[model samples]
Target: MGYRRLDKHILKAIFHRWIESQSISRIHREEGFDRKTIRSYIELFEAKGLRPGLQMPDEDLDCVLQELLPKNTRGRNKRELLAPYREELLRLVNPDASSGDPESPAERPAEVVRPKTAYLILVEKYRLEVSYETFKLYAREIGLTAQSKRAPTRLESPPGQETQIDYGTVGTLVDHHNGKARRVYAFAAKLSCSRLPFIQFTYTQNKESWMESNIAMVEFYGGVTECLLIDNLKSGVLKPDLWDPQINRGYAEFAEHYRTFIDTARVGKATDKAKIERLIPQARELFRRLKAIHPTWSLDELNRQALLWCRQEYGRAVHGTTGIAPMSLFEEQEQSLLKSLPPVRFEVPRYKPVKVHPDRFFTFEHKRYAMPENCRGQSFIARESGGILRVFDASYRLIRSYPVTEQRVCWLPGDFPKSREALMQGAYPRYLLSRARTLGPAAERLIDGI
Candidate 1:
């Protein structure tokens, strides 16, 4: 009877009648099956609670029965076989056991319990005869190994209180004008209150790009939040700290201009800005779908499309958490709470520390700017602010300014004397001729000795 195999039709028929409370003899007669066969299948189903008159569905019962019947019953008895090594394995899993005094549990000092790898213990200590796979299976079955799952927690901020920002790569974007593919990055700013998001794309993530994007985001949102949350990007955050964070001077100055505070998330904690982290994946989906629809567009066109998507599609769509459209929520609840934009816009710039040349000049953007005074080889920070280069001393005081131009050399009126000797050493005759021309045509003819 144990070796007999019944067709699916017969097995199901017997299962239905058995569940209906029919006598075994009657089911055997009605289905034309031997009494013993009916009893066997009926017994199997009833044992697993597939009893008659139960409310469970037939499909679920069938699936459970299949799983129970086909499972191989032959295997090593893991618990019985590994019983001798149980104590040793437990000790390895909890090495702090040795640190505790054996005489009293109360005397045990606090210590970190490190989890030892199963392979090391098996190979070095036990030298178990079984394969690694078998050893691992036994360890799991005996509860020496446990897997943990992490649950993500979300945080919320009051309206107009905080904004979280981050940058993500958008893979390679083809430039329609040049027919060349360039890697692009997307910067996202999400308001913690309404989950309203603003996105902009750029070719690079330098200080200038970051600052410009931030300004654009605030302007687009119509106001700035009280505090701006950002990751440890070198463009904005100089050093990440739990209590006191160090922000880049330029970024700090920019924030000050907007009357907003900068808050940096702890290093390596994405949950600190969970709102932005959650929006990134959804933004990527939008980017992919938009790219497919257009295929090739200039950065300006792509940005236009992004703005439309943010306003028309994402903003108007109901959020999963709040059950209200982001744009509606922002306009109704968060907009009024935000701080108004400042009167004057901040001019963003790239900053770098440079040493004054022996000739009292510093090079930036392939052009030289003569220092206003003799810095005498001292270090200074040069701010390449748009069309102008502003030089600041160690104290960040403005000491020199020059227009960034195509000229190979530029000089301040006060700096010509400091560089005069160096220029003469290189081209004394030419320098004299140039200086003569600057004076007048009469001086030039006189210097020519005509």
Candidate 2:
């Protein structure tokens, strides 16, 4: 039957002989035709929205689902499946006896046992997941995700355990304080395991703000976190990764005082320290409302108002991503994490030594830069960062910094001394300004000023 010529009549005969509900492979076998002919006929029937030869199970559906949920979800789904208290919903509804104590992560306060939840413990067993919807779907299918499950994340710093930092845009509009406004970059911090968020506002997201914000965030978080996590914001981290991230030495030294490990999120990965990611959207929401009111004032005032707005509106609301209010979550998981709030919590960001020359200025592009006088005549290290110019003694102490780009700029500090030698700047001023007043009063005045 399989060798018979395939045609409409033969196909029709085969179709009638096989059951209407039979699979294509089964029908081909029963009808004595190859699967190719049967499948071709099925495709033709499907074009008209009619049943193809047979409706078959989709084996690839599982494959696609697995691919989509590959990162951490498979393990999460399995743990959720094998859990004991899988059906409980642990919402942070109203605080009763079960309501945990309020612990501010910035306090890095004393440790204590807080009121605990079934799913919070259950969630840990599954693995720390940021997306609740994704967690629940897999949990429902396999094991323990409750709709109201709380994830017990220790984002709060351990008496200086960890700091989370990022730069976010603050929306400003016409109605706002400054008639026209530019986006403000916010540097925020929170304890990693505890999750108490602190923020600072700055003019730009450049190296200055990048480091200053970290300084401010540490102060806001109540003390230095022993470890810090950040994105590859060129000003802060030159190279980014889970392992081997290159920290701007200037930023790394700042962390050293707090005895912290500086880690950066891997290229393209956002969930490395996701509690911070969850907090940033709320910052935009606050700015959106305040910017509409057109609150007018200095950058400081605007930031003050913005902070107040966040505390009032967003601080009390339950987090969209986490199942708990940020404040409440901070109080519960982070209080127990505080080690000993150190005495030295504040430090003005400082710079290191990079080298530049005296005769020819270092050019960071079209702009020329200047180093300290002491580095003069000798090969010296000059370090400039965060809107600061610091020339170092060979032993490496602060020297001097010139302000404003005048004939030079130093974008990447690493190339300072070496770049100064480039011959482009060595050329004398082209066509010295004649001043066009050789014998006149204008010439005399120019000479006097010079």
Candidate 3:
């Protein structure tokens, strides 16, 4: 009969039957094993001082079996091939080992090397002959390598405490007005506690679009969270820092208007605002499905469909992580906790610093607007919104307001100095005549004739 390996459970059953005073032949018949196999196991147990009537504890039996069974050497030959370079492999994986003992510095290189890279280095430099898989297995067995990943800790937030926001690209779509294809992006917002999502699609991801999307999201939810978590997009965050991030001026005003706080995620760290980060992919997939069904949809129509999907499908469907529908959670548990919206919606404005020229004029949107003579050659803040440009002094005091028109030059009567005002108001001819009269009668007559 061929040799067969018996597990601890099988051996324990055989011993139990033998201890019950069953004959070897009967035990073999009942256990479906050859009589010789049963007799051999009994003989081995007897040799180990385990009498037929004596009861052996499970732990003691396991220990006895461990000592009696032959050691598994299936991969012994492969491990022996790597034995010579074990120290080298360990050194490559553990760069800090060299610093532990200062008495004798490690001769091997001290730079940290990944296991796969180390395996390649060993094959190339040291001429070690072993497959990458074999090297990894042996390295793990010898404790030269270990998994660096650990289970991630889930972040929990109170309802209405925070909202996470992000922007993701949804493929290009044709503009209904222009009939030209434009790259489109989806703006996603999610409440941290409810996993409630609000999605908006736009042709641009500029500062204007960013603020507009945020406003629309808040209006859709009919409330605002206490804090807004967002990625370090240039439109929202001017500079990204771990401790002190610089928020965009317009976005700051938007937050202030809604009585909310703006918090930015760390640069390149998606897990900082994982709630919104997780929504982007799902939003993209939803948009793709919408586009597939309505291939000729315009940007506006696409946005309309996306909002409907968020309300009827995405929001109503149970979330994989929360196991609850987002809209249901929001309506049942989160909506009342949020802060109330302002009486009037915020007017999105673009903030820029503009310098008044020596001629008492400043340029905005390629059009020149005249400043007060006293305010000439000074830097002022220009806030443009609702077809109007409002200029503010350094102290944030109102300077002048002008209609953002298509006219090349925008000026008021008081914008110029007293001296220039005369020239601007058609008084230059009279002034010239007066000067000519002072000069000579002939000059005055010549000026009059001209």
Sort every candidate by lDDT, greatest first: 3, 1, 2
Query: Model 3, poorest ten-residue lDDT window?
Result: 95-104
Question: Which is better, 1 or 3, measured by TM-score?
Answer: 1
lDDT tens digits, residue span 1-450, model 2: 334555445555554444266777778677776787677665644553445354434454233223322143144554444344322221121122122334634323221111122223334544454354544564455433324534334343344356677777654334344466555666665556544566656667766567666665555444565567787888888776666877886677776766677778777766666777866755654444343333455667667875554454445678655666666765566545544455755344444333365653554334555554444556445555455555556666655465544544443344344334343445222212233355677765666565
Give the C-alpha miss distance for residue 335 in model 1, angstroms.
0.6
Q: After the best TM-score superposition of candidate 3, give how far the Cα of residue 86 lies from its true spot, in angstroms.
A: 51
Off by over 4 Å in 2: 1-161, 173-180, 309-312, 319-324, 332-336, 339-380, 383-450
- Candidate lDDT values, in order: 0.76, 0.53, 0.82
RMSD of 1: 17.0
Instruction: After the best TM-score superposition of candidate 2, give how far the Cα of residue 70 lies from its true spot, in angstroms.
Output: 50
- Output the number of the TM-score-best candidate: 1
- Weakest 10 consecutive residues of candidate 2 by summed lDDT: 89-98
lDDT of 1 by residue, 25-86 (tens): 89977888788767777767767867677777778867766654544455886435566765
**CA RMSD of each candidate after superposition:** 17.0, 21.8, 14.2
In model 3, the runs with Cα more than 4 Å from the true position are 1-153, 372-378, 386-388, 393-400, 403-407, 412-419, 422-448
Could you estimate the TM-score for every candidate?
Answer: 0.62, 0.45, 0.62
Best by lDDT: 3
lDDT preference between candidates 2 and 3, better one: 3
